[model samples]
Target: MNKRIFSIGLALMLGAAYSLTAFSQVKPETLVKQRQAAMILQGKYWGPLGGMAQGKVPYDATVVARNAGFLEALSKMPWDGFAPSTKDVKSAALPAVFTDTAKFKEAQDRLQSEVSKLVAVSKGGAEAAVKAQLVATGKTCGGCHETFREKQ
Candidate 1:
């Protein structure tokens, strides 16, 4: 009975240690993929609103509000994945993302700030302001991409 209890405890301890190591040492490539996924989702939410601002798509306030809310959430996701480990990973992110750390962080903050403003403005039901904010948000994204992302 004691031997069985000891075996069970040993198995549980080994499982916990393995879980910690697996989660704590996430592969750099995986991190890059996660960040990219977050950015893609951000674009998915932002594209329609951006198109509306650019006159390519018809304006829809309901959609704007929904996407703005989504952007606010997504904007917070990608930054952590730009860890030092990912600096060595081959991705669309430029070297500036790691070398120009302050600028990269500033860009991240700008995106989050702009998205937050968009979320707030969207809730106000002001179409013109929302459209303007969408343009402003797009500019933040473009500015960051110009500095930190490779050209498509």
Candidate 2:
């Protein structure tokens, strides 16, 4: 009967919806992928600024402001992905990221703080100050990687 077919279709739809909701919650591999994607984006925004700070790339205020803004936002994206669930996931993060939890958090805070400063400095359009902040931010990144990330 038409009613029976309709009921079956509704049940199937409900089951599919439930399955989607279940899978939408963060999984260990998903968290790892999210953090890695955030890091990759951070690098994409940071590379040019790093080159400028080192005098390899010519500094452009427009690019600096744009990239700094992107960096500031990206900096906050990775920390939650470092959740305990991700500990068993294979990632570029080293054991220290879980073992030295306090240190890892401090490094995350440092990167966020440094990128915030870079965003502020870039808005001022002062080339020297922006470049200086870029170096400082890059060092914050390097310091964290030295302690927490696996070498590529």
TM-score versus the correct structure, for each prediction: 0.86, 0.83
Candidate 2 residue-pair clash tally? 0
Clashing residue pairs in candidate 2 (N, C-alpha, C atoms within 3 angstroms): none
Worst 10 residues of 2 by lDDT: 20-29
lDDT of 2 by residue, 1-152 (tens): 69999999999999999998875676889889988999999999999999999999998999999998888789999888888878888878998988999998999899999888888888875788888888999999999999899887
Per-residue error for 90 in candidate 2, Å, reads 1.3
lDDT tens readout by residue for model 1, 1-152: 69999999999999999999987799999999999999999988888998999989999999999998888889999988999998888999999898999998998889889888898999966888888899999999999999889999
| lDDT of candidate 1 at residue 117, scale 0 to 100 | 89
- Residue 45 of model 2: what lDDT? 94
What's model 2's TM-score?
0.83
Each candidate's lDDT (Cα)? Answer: 0.91, 0.89
